[model samples]
Target chain A: MSIAWYLAVSGIVFSLGAFGVMTRRNPLVVLLCLELMLNGANLALIAFSRMWGNGDGQILALVVMTVAACEVCIGLGMIVAIYRRRLPINVDELRELQG
Target chain B: MSTVLFFLAASGVISGAVGVVVLRNPFYSVLALVAHLVSLAVLFLLLRAEFVAAVQVVVYAGAVMVLYVFVVAYVGGESDSVGERLRGAGGTGSSGSSLRLGGAILAGALLVELLIALLGTGLEAIGGYGAPYSPGPQSFGTPAYIGKLLLTRFLLAFEMASFLLLIAAVGGVVLARRRGGLGEEDERDLLTPLDLMRPRETGTMAEGVGGRTP
Candidate 1:
C-alpha cells in the first residue's frame, strides 16, 4: 500500500474523531473520540517510520501509548469523582469552571 | 496480501469509529472502540511495527478498555435519555441546531482539506522521504530491536514514562477515594473485601439464599 493511502486513512479517522468531539455531549464518548484522533496520529507515525527505515517513529508511538494510558487513568478518575458528586456524568452540567 | 489486509483493517477501523460515534448505547460505543483499537493494531502490524502492535493490544485493548467497561457498568447511570438528548435536539437550546450544523461543516472542511493536501503532494513527494517500499532488516520492528533502542537511546524517555505511570496510579486512587476519609457511610458505600471475593448477585441476600435452598 502506498504511504498516501495510509495518510488519507489517518486524515479521515482524525476528522471523524474531531466530529465526535464536537458533537458528542458525553465526556466519556468525547474522550474515546480523542483516542481515535491519537490513534490516527499514531498510524501516520508508523507509516512514516516504515518509510524512513528508522526506529524513532516507533519509539515515539510507544511514548504516545504511555501518555494515552496515563490520560485514561486520570480521565476516568475525574469521571468517577464527577459521578459521585452529581450522580450522573454530564459535560453540560459542568459549568463551574466557566469564567 | 498486505494490501488486502490493509483495506480490510482500514474498513474495520473506520466503521468501528463511526459506530462509536453513532451508537446510542455507551456499552456498544465501548465495544466499537475495542474493535477500532484491535484493527489499528492490525494496521500497525501491516506497517511492520510488530512490537508497537503487541503493546497496543496489551495496553489499550486489555487494560484501558477493561477500566472503561468497569466504569460504564458500575458508576454510569442508565441514562438512555442522555443519548436521546444528544440525538434529539443537541441539548444547547436555541443554539443547538446551529452548533451541530457548524460542527458538521467544520469537520467536512477539515476532511476535504486533508484529502487535498495528501493528493496534491503527489505520491512521489511522499515516497522521497525515505526508502519507500523497503521493509528494512528482518529485526527492524522486533521486540529485541525496540528494547535495545529503549535502553540505549530513549532511556530517559522510557524511565520518565514509568514515573508517569506510577504518578497516574497514585493520583487515580487519591482522586477516586472520598475526600472525607473512610467514614461509616463511606465505608458502607465502598466495596468491602468480602464483596470483592463474592460473585455479584442481582437480588437480596435472603432471596439468593432462599433460591439456593430449593
Candidate 2:
C-alpha cells in the first residue's frame, strides 16, 4: 500500500488516543493513551523512513521509545505516591495545583 | 503479500486502540494496550524497521507494560478505589463529564485536519503506492548500523538518553517513597485553595472547582 495509507492509519490511532486521554478519569489510563499517541507518531516515522529510504526515522523512533519509558516511569511514580497518600485516584478529585 | 499483511496488522492496531479507550476497567484497558503495542510492532516490521520492531516488543511490551502492570496491580489489588472514584464522579454524560464530549469533538476535528493536510500535499514527491521499496545500505535496520550511528553521529544524544534513564530511576524512587512529615493535622494535599475558600458548607470538590466565583 501507499505510505499515505500508513499515515492515515497513524492519524486515526492518534485521535483515538487523544479521545481516551480526554475521557478517562484514571491517570493510568491517561498514560496508556499517551503511549498510543506516541505509537501513532512512530508509525509515521517508520513509514516515511521506508519512503525516503533511510534509517533516520527509525533512529528517531527509538529515541521516542526512550522518552516514553521515562514519561511512564515518572507518571507512575506520581500515581503511586498519590495512592500512598490516600488521595482520590480520580483526576477530577486531585486539583491541588489548579489556579 | 506485504499489503495483505499490512491490512491485517492495521486491523489489529485499530481494534486494540478502540479497546483501550472503551474498556471500562483499566486492567482490561492495559491488556488492550498490549495488543495495540504488539500490532504496532508488526507494522514496524512491515516497514522494515527490524531493530525497532524487536525493541518495541521487548522494551514496550516486555518492560514498560510490566512496570505499568506492577503499579496498577499494586494500586488495584488493594481495592478498586480508583475505578470506583472514576465511575462515580466521571461517568459518561454526567454534567461534569463535558470534557469527554469536548474531547470527542476535538479529536474528530483533529483527524479531519490531518487528513486534509495529508491529502492536499500528497506523498507524491516520493513514491506513494507501489513505490519501489529500496533497501538502502545492507546495515540499515541492523543493530550494528544503529549502534555505530549512536556512538559516532549521535554520541551526545545517546549519552544523554542514558543519563535520562538514570534520572528517571532516581526520581521514581524519591517520589514514591513514604515520608511521614505530614500528619492528620496537615490535610493540605486534600484541600486546594478553591476548596478552602468556597465555604465548607456547600458543593462537592468537583463542583467547587467548576463553580468558582473568582
Candidate 3:
C-alpha cells in the first residue's frame, strides 16, 4: 500500500477524534478523543519516517507518547477529583473558568 | 500481503476511532482506544518501526489504558449522568443541541478538507502502490538506536520529558489528595465551591460529604 492510504486513515481517525472532543460532555471521553488525535498524528509521523527512511519520526512518536501519558494521568486525576467533589461531570456544567 | 495487513490495521484504526466517539460509556471508549492504539502499533510495524510499535503497545495499550479503566470504574457510570440530566432539565437547551449539531458539522467539514488536502498533496510525494517492502537497517527503531539519538541529538528533550513526567506525577498526587487531609474529614472543604451553582445544587456527590463541605 502507498503512504497515502495511511495518511487518509490517519486523517479520518483524527477527524473522528475531533468530533468526539467537540461533542462529548464527559471529560474522560474528551481525553480519549485527544488520545485518538495524538495517535492519528503519530501514525502519519511514523509513515513519513518510513518514507524518508529515518528514525526521527519514531523517536518523535516516543516523546509524544510520553506527553500523552502525562496528559491522561493529570486529566483523569482532575476528573476523579471533580467527581469526588459532587461537581457535575459534564464539561458544559463545569464552566467555572468561563470568562 | 503487506497491503492486506495495512488494510486490516487501517480498518481497526478507523473503527476503533469511531467506537471511541460513538460509545457513550467511558469504559467502552477506553477499550476502543486500546484497540486503536494496538492497531496503530501494527501499522508502525508495517512502517518498520519495531521499537516504537512495541512501546505503543506497552505504554499506550498497557499502562495508559489500565489507568483509564481504573478511573472509569472509580468514577462509576454516574460520571456521565450529568449530561443527560442537564439535557432533560433543558439546562443548556437549544444552544446545547445546536452546539452538538454545529460540532458534528464542523468536524465533518474538517475531515473533508483534510482528506482533500491529503489526497491532493500527501499522496504524490510518498511511495506509490505496490512498493516492495524494504526493511531498513537492522539498527532502525531499536531502543539502542533511539537511545543514541536521544542522548546525542535530542538529549535536552529527553531530560525535559523526564522532568515533565516527574511534574505530572506530583501534580496528580496533589490533585488527588483530599482537601481535608488523608484521613481527616473536611472542616469546611476549601475546595468544590468554585461553581456558581453552589456545591449543593447538583446533589451529585456522595450525600454527606458535599453537604458538610460548605
Candidate 4:
C-alpha cells in the first residue's frame, strides 16, 4: 500500500526532473531538478526496503544523503566559479564547449 | 485507503514535476521542485521508512534546498540574462534547438523505458517472498544500529567523508574570500631583485637573456 504511494511520488519527482532538465535554460535549476530526481529514487528505495522489512533500504538512504551532500558542495563550487568567470549560467551558453 | 492515498500523492508529485520542467521562470521551477521533494518525503513515511524519510526532509529539503536557494539568489542577474538569451535559441542555426530536440528524444525514451521496467517488474503484492520477514526480536529499528554501522564497520568511511566535507568547507571559504578579496601587499618590495632573478626559478630565461647581456 505504502509502496504504491512511494512509487507514484517518485515517478512524479522523476518526471519533474526530466522536464526541468529538458526545458529550463538555467543550469542551477537543472541541478535542482537533478537533485529532485535523485531524492525520488531514494524515496523509492526506502519504500521498497520498508515493504521488505530490511535495513538495506535505510542504509541506502544514508548513502544517498552523503552523496547528495557531496554533490551539493561540488556543484555549488562549480556554479560560483562559473559565475565569477562571468560565464553564462544558462544551458544555451554552454554550447561554446561543443565542437 | 493506502492505494488511494498513494495515487493522490503520486498525481501531486507528477504535476508538480511537470511544473518544474515546463515553467520558464527559475523561481517557479524551484517551487515545483520543492513540492516534488516534500511529496517524495511523505511517500517515504508511508512506506514505513521513517528514518529515511526524516533524513530526506532534513538533508534534502532542509540543507540542499537552502544551498540551492542561496546560489539562485546570488545568480539572480545571470538568470534574467538567460531569459533574454533564450530568444536566440529558436532558429535552426542555434545548437540550443538541436540539443533541446535531442534532450527531448532522450527523455522520452528513458521515460518509456522506466514505464516498461516498472510495469514488467512483478512487485505488486507486498512481501511476496512468503511472509513479510520481521527483524530479530531484539533488532527493532533503532538509532543504535545505524550509529553502530557508521562507527564500527563504516568508521573509516565515515571519518573520510567528514574529512572530505572539511576540505569542501575550507575550499568554499577560500573561494568566497577570493571572490570578495582585499589584502595589502607592498608593491615595491614584495619581490626583491635577487628573488625575481633566481636562475633556477626563471628556468631557461636565466641562461638565455641574462647570460647574453655582455
Best by TM-score: 3
Model 3, runs deviating above 4 Å: B89-95, B122-124, B127-137, B183-214
lDDT of 1 by residue, A14-38 (tens): 8989998898777788888888889
lDDT of 1 by residue, B118-195 (tens): 657655646443454444454778898899999999999999999999999999998788876656775584556776
lDDT of 3 by residue, B1-214 (tens): 9989988988998999999998877888889888888888998888778889989988789988999999889888556655666576976577867988999999999999988877787345565642234545546666777878899999898999999999999999988777865665674465655555554546545655557554
Candidate 2 lDDT over residue span B1-214, tens digit each: 9889999999999999999998877888889999999998999888778889999999999999999899889888323344555556665436535776788999999899877776567458434652355565654677777777778888887888899999999999998887876666667667687876766548777666777554
State each model's CA lDDT, in order: 0.82, 0.83, 0.83, 0.66
Tens-digit lDDT string for candidate 4 (B103-170): 77777776666655654577764323212544553342346656766777777767877787788777
Query: In candidate 3 chain B, what residue range of length 10 has the lowest lDDT sum?
Result: B129-138
Please give, for residues A1-99, the per-residue lDDT of candidate 4 as tens digits: 535545545655665567566766678777777776777677667666766666666776777777767777777777787788777676666776532
Looking at model 2, the pairs that clash are none
TM-score value, chain A, candidate 1: 0.93
Error of 3 at B175 (Å): 0.8
Q: Which residue ranges in model 1 land beyond 4 Å of their true spot?
A: B83-94, B122-138, B185-214
Query: What does candidate 2's lDDT look like per residue over A1-99, in tens digits?
Result: 778888888999999999988877788888999999999999988888887776778888988999999999999999998888888777777899531
For candidate 3, the per-residue lDDT at A98 reads: 32
Interface RMSD of 4: 3.3
Screening candidate 3 with a backbone cut-off below 3 angstroms (N, C-alpha, C), the clashing residue pairs are: none
- Candidate of highest DockQ: 1
Candidate 2 error regions (>4 Å): B77-93, B125-137, B181-214
By DockQ thresholds, what CAPRI class is model 2? acceptable
Ranking by TM-score: 3, 1, 2, 4
